[model samples]
Target: MLMFATNDQLLKNAIDDLGKYVDLKDLGEPRYILGIQVNHDKKEQKIKREQKITLNQRKQIDDILKTFHMEDCKAVKTPMDVSQWKQSLARATESKQATNCPDVPYQSLMGHLMYLVQGTRPDIAFATNYRLWW
Candidate 1:
């Protein structure tokens, strides 16, 4: 369990209180949490109002792509219009067409991608949602 408090004394007190009931080992500041890289600047963090912390999941995204065998895929720089997506989905899921993937774990792939979308990649949320629904 990770807990933070503005006051150092209060946080130490809480930790001490919890330690009595549970075996607690302070891991000291976290470097990463849940595959997201935690970037902290102590100098910059001095000012509470202007302080900023960044969380990155590039490693997780790359691992996801490699796991799904999409490492060498080309990047789509152009922004696709919503209409184009609807048209694409319509053709892909036509009533007469029989689409089946017996070998590929498509649902599993979609589920993994969905996690990425929820974490830090909202850009692919629509695509993941469509795959999950359709």
Candidate 2:
């Protein structure tokens, strides 16, 4: 399946002429393609690509929250504490002995965070990368 967009009537006419010798089905203007929502502003002559959170993404986040028992946690203004995080990192490095921290699903959580990073939550990229080193 081939998809294309053109505003020129000459091109449309050319395509229609070629259609006589080839099989083609025009699906018309597109609103969505490959999971990304497309919005066209004809008046402004601009197009925008929007990534909406899917139901599966919502479920993944909910499941992660439930796994960590943070389903009822309150939303915070800031997502990270830089000073506290630095202090903790310093302590971990200074202590030669390994800490007996409970095994958290860090990899799984990071996988989800990566998807968020690739999607709409790019603000969390730095924090997520920092946590990966821990």
Query: Which lDDT tens digits does candidate 2 get at residues 30-51?
Result: 6554333455456454333422
Best candidate (score: TM-score):
1
Q: The CA-based lDDT of model 2 is what?
A: 0.63
Per residue, candidate 1 scores C-alpha lDDT tens digits across 15-45 of 9999999999888778789877877777777
lDDT of each: 0.75, 0.63
Candidate no. 2 TM-score: 0.48
Q: How close is candidate 1 to the true structure, as a TM-score?
A: 0.74
Top candidate when judged by lDDT against the true structure: 1
Candidate 2 local Cα displacement, residue 112, angstroms: 1.4
Provide the TM-score for each candidate, comma-separated: 0.74, 0.48
